[model samples]
Target: MAHEKRAYPLWTELPYAGKTHSPTIAGGVEPDAGKWKTYFIQHSRRHGFKKLDGRPIRLAIKDPDSIDWYAQLKVVQHTLENLSDQEKRIAEYWSAGPPTKQWIPIVDRLIDTYAIEAPRAARILSAVFGGMNDAFVVCWALKYKWLVPRPNQLDQHLATYICTPEHPSYPSGHATISGAAEVILSYFFPAERQKLHRLAEENAQSRLYAGVHYPVDNTEGLRLGRQIGRIVIEELKKDTVNGLPIERSSREFRNADIITRTYEQAIPFDYKSKCDSLLIRDDESTGNSSTKDWIDPKLFI
Candidate 1:
C-alpha cells in the first residue's frame, strides 16, 4: 500500500471551512500511485467497463486518477463518514443548534434594512463590518486549533439536516461573526443592542438549522466574538484605520447600557417607516454627539 499527498479541491473547502485537523500517520500504508492506477483498471474490468469499446472505456482511461474513477474517492468518502458519525455522538451532551430562538425575526428585519442612507449607510456598515473581520479570523483559527467535530456525525439521536461540513466544531464561525457585527453596530445605535444581540445569536443558530454546526459551537463562538468586539472597541479608542475614527475622548463617551437605552427610546421600534423624521438633529453626525473629541489622526496608535 502506498499513499499520495493529494490536495483537496477548492470547492470542497467550503464544507470543511475551519477544519485544521491533520491525519495521523499511525501505521498507515503509503499509497503507490502506479499500483493505484493498476487497481483502478482491475476494478473497471470487474465492473465490466473493459467490455466497452468507445466512450465509457475512453472516459475511464482519460480519468483514471480522478477520485470517483479511482481509490481517493473511497478514502475521502469514508474519512468524512467516520468523522460525521463521531460528531453525532458528541452532539448528544448538548443541543444541536442555535442557543436562542427569540432573535430570528429581529435579524430578519435588520438584514432586510441593511441598506438605509445609500453611501453613508454603506460606509457605516462597512466600518462596522471591519470591526467584525478580526473576530471571524481569530475564531476560525481557534476552531482549527480546537479541532472539535460537529454534531451531525457524532450523535445518533441528533438528526442533522445539512450535509456535514468538513470543519472542526468548537467556536461557531457564524455566532462569532454575527456577535462582533452586533457589538459594533450596537455601539453606534445603543437602543438596538438587545435586538442586535438577539440577531447575532440567531444567526449563529441558523448554522445548526443549516445542519453545519452544533449548539456548543455557537455558545463558545459567541463568547469569543464578544471578546474580540471589546478588544476592537478598546483599540479603536487608541488608533485609526484608513481615516475611520477609532478613538474617542473619555469625556464624550457614555456607558454602553445608558447610551443604548436612550437610543431605543429615541428611535422607537418602528422607526424605519419614519426615516424622514430621524434626522441627525444637529451635527451629531460630525461633532461628537456623546461629547467626545474626534480621535486625532496623530493620536491614533
Candidate 2:
C-alpha cells in the first residue's frame, strides 16, 4: 500500500531534517527533498537552485575536544539518533495500523489486576509495556558520541519495520534495555524465564523486523542487558527478610497459589477484604511471609 504524503507541521519536519540549528522555534518553511533544512535554510538562490551535501548531519555535532575526536570515530550520537528515529517511526506505524485490538484489553487487564494484588508482577508487566525508554536513553547518549549510518543508506533493498533512522548504528540500545528488564523480571518468574528471555530477544529482533538495527548492534545490546539484569538480581537478593526476597511473596504469587489450590478457588481481592492492605505493609516492613501460602512460583522460587 502506498502512503500519500501529508503536509506535516513545519516545526516537526525541521528537526527531522537534521541541520545545525540551535534549540529555537522553527521558521515557517517545509523541507524540499533537495534543500538543507538546518538552523537556517541555506540555499543557492542567486545561482540556479542547488543543494549542499557537504557532510552527513551526524558529523556536524562534533567539536574539537579529545572526547569529541574519539566520538567521531565511535559515532555514538549518530547511532542513537538513527535508532530513535527508527523507534518513533515504528511506533507511529503501529499506532496508525495496529495488528489487533484484542491484545490491548488482555494486556491492560493483566497490568491492572496484577499491579495491586501482585506489585512485583505488576512491575514486571509494566517493565515490558514501555521499557524501551532505557534503550532510547542509551541510543541518544551514544548518538552524541558516534555518527554511524543505517543499513538503508548503505543498501536500499533492506526492508524494515519502520523507515531507517538517519544516523549511525552500533550498540543496539533497544536490545540492551529490553534484555536487562526481561532478565531482571525472569529472576522473579524463573519457570517463565525461558519465555521471558524469548520475549526480550524478540523485542530486540523487532528492530530488525523494523529494519533499523544491524545484527551485531542488537546482539551486543542483549549481552549488555543480561549483565545489567544479573546485577539487578544480585541487588534485589539483598532486599529480603532473613535471606528471602519480599518481591517473590507478592500478590501475583499468592494468586498463582490460589489457582493451584483448587478448581473452585475464589477470586482473591474483594471490596471489603483487609488482606489487600495487610500485604502492602508486610512488604514495606521486610516481614517474612510463610512459604506455605498461595505464592506465585515465578516470583518466589
Candidate 3:
C-alpha cells in the first residue's frame, strides 16, 4: 500500500480519466485533447477541405484479451535483458515528454531537409502535431480501458532505465504520438517516407528498451496512432491558392520558416534516471556488468 498510495494521479477531475487499480490505470481519456477536436482552425472537418460532421475514421484499439500477452512479455524481457547503453540513451530521451517538445528537433530537421517555405512549414507542423495530439486522446482512452500493467509490476525485481509513466501500459503514449507524427509528416514530405517511418519504429522500440512498457503496448499504440494520423492527413490535403494546389497556414506557427533546434538546448526534461550510472554488460546471456560513468546524453534532459 505504501508505493501504491504514492502513485500520482494523471487526471482525477475528468470522468473519462478512469480509475486506478493495482498500480494499473483504467478508463483513460484526455478531455483537453477532446476539446482540441472542436478546434477547427487547423484542420477540422467543419473548416477544412472536407466538411464531414464527424471524424474521418474511428480509432481501432483492440481488446486486451486478444493480445498474446505471454509472448509480449517475452519480447519486453528480451529487450531489457539485451539493452545496451546506447539504446538506453535513446529510450531515456523519449521518456522525458510528449511530442510538443521532444519532437521539435525531428520536425526542424525535416524542414531543413526539404527547405520548406515558412507558411507551408507551418501547415505541415500543424497537421503533424495536431494529429499527434489526436492520437494521444485515442491511445490513452484505450490504455485505461485496457488497464494493462507496466513491466515492473509483473516482475518486482525489474529495474527500468527510466521512470515509468503513471498510466496503463497497453498502448505507449510516445509510440502512439510518434506513429501519428510519422504518417502525417510523410504525407507532407513523401520523399522522406522511409526515414520518417524508421523514426516511428525506433520511437516504439524505445519503450521496450526502457523496460517500462511491453512489446504489444508499442505495437498496438503505433497501429492505432497511424490510423489517426491518416485521418488528419486526409483533412490536411484539402487546400487551394487561387485554384492552384497548395497547403500552409493551417494553424499558428513560429515566425521563422526554417526552424531548427539545437539538441543540447532543446531537451524537454530533467528528471534523474531511476537506474544506476553507465555500465555495459559484457554478455547478454551471462548478465555480467562493469561500471563507468558515461557522458550525459543531453545537457537539459
Candidate 4:
C-alpha cells in the first residue's frame, strides 16, 4: 500500500495546513521505515538471540473499507465529543514528546527509588531501551505496510486535540513503546508490575483521547510491543558469566506504592470486547469450533 496525505488540514496552526506529509520530504522523521528491522539489541548476538524481524507480524484487524472499520471510527468520534477533563489532561501529558521522553524519566525514578546499583541500573536501561527500539522497528514496518490513515484522515470533519503525527496510524508508536517499557521494567521490578501496566494502558488510551488513533491501533500496538519485550527478556536470560545466568532482582517500597496509588482509577475503554463478540459470532456461523484456529501463532511467538 502507498502512504497518502491527510485529507483535512492539521488542527494545529502551522504550515501543515497547505503542505502534505511525506516521510521522504525534508522535515520528515525516519524516511526509511524498513532500515531498522534487522537491528540487534546489545546482548542479542552474545546470547544467540535471532535478530527481530517485524515483517512477519500482522494485526488481526478489519479492512479499512469494512463496516467494522467505520464502527471503530465512530468510537473515536464518540470519544472526542465526550472527552472528560481527565482524558484531555491525559492526552496532553503523553503528547509532550515521543514515548522515550517520558519513559526515560520513569526508568530514572525507578532506579533512584529502589537504590539500584550501577550494574543493575545499566542493565535496566539497556534492556528497556533496546526492547523499545525493536518495538518501534516492528510498529513502523507494519504502519507503512498497512498505511492506515489517522482517524482525522478518515473523517475530514474530525479535529484532534493534538496534532496528528506524520506517519501512518495502524499501531500507535506511543502504545508500542509503553508496552515494551511496561514489560521490561516489570521484569526488573515485579512489585511495580500493576502500576507499570496501568501506565502503559493509559499511554495507549491517550492516543484515542487525542482523537488521533482507532482503538485497534492501541490494542494491536500493545500486543506487538509486549511480544518484543518478552523476546528481549528471553535474550537477557541467556546472558551468562561463566555459565551462570546474570542476577535479576526485584524491589518494593511503601513510598512507591503510595505514590502510584494516587493515579486515577477508572475502567479503560473495552476495545476488545466488540472484536471478541464478532469472533464468537463467526465461530457460530461456521462449523469451526477451535479457538486456536482463529489465533495468529506468530503474535504469541
**Which candidate leads the pack in lDDT?**
4
TM-score of each: 0.42, 0.43, 0.69, 0.71
lDDT of 2 by residue, 1-301 (tens): 1214322111122222113331122221111212323211123445312213322112111121212222232342344345544443333232121211212332344345345356665655544333333333333444333433444433323323343333344455566665666676556555445555664675565555444555555666677556545544554556677877666553233222211112121222211211110111123322312211222211110
Better of 1 and 4 by lDDT: 4
Q: Count the backbone clashes (under 3 Å) in each candidate.
A: 26, 25, 1, 0
Ranking by TM-score: 4, 3, 2, 1
Q: How does candidate 2 score on lDDT? A: 0.38
How displaced is residue 124 in candidate 4, in Å?
A: 1.0
Mind giving the per-residue lDDT tens digits that candidate 3 earns over 59-84? 56666766665567677777777777
RMSD over all Cα atoms, model 1: 23.3
List the lowest-lDDT window of 10 residues for candidate 1: 271-280
Task: Write out the backbone clash pairs for model 4.
Answer: none
Per-residue error for 71 in candidate 1, Å, reads 36
- Reference-based TM-score, model 3: 0.69
Q: State the lDDT of candidate 4 residue by residue for 1-301, as single tens digits.
A: 3325443222221222113432322233453543464334321323322434423333333333332556778999999788776786677567654666667667887888888899989988888887888788767755655566566655655656555566667778888888888998888888888888988999899989877788988887888788778777877887899998886554554345412333332222211111110111123323222221322211111
Model 1 clash number:
26
Task: Looking at model 3, report the run of 10 residues with the lowest lDDT sum.
Answer: 10-19
* Model 3: lDDT of residue 91: 70
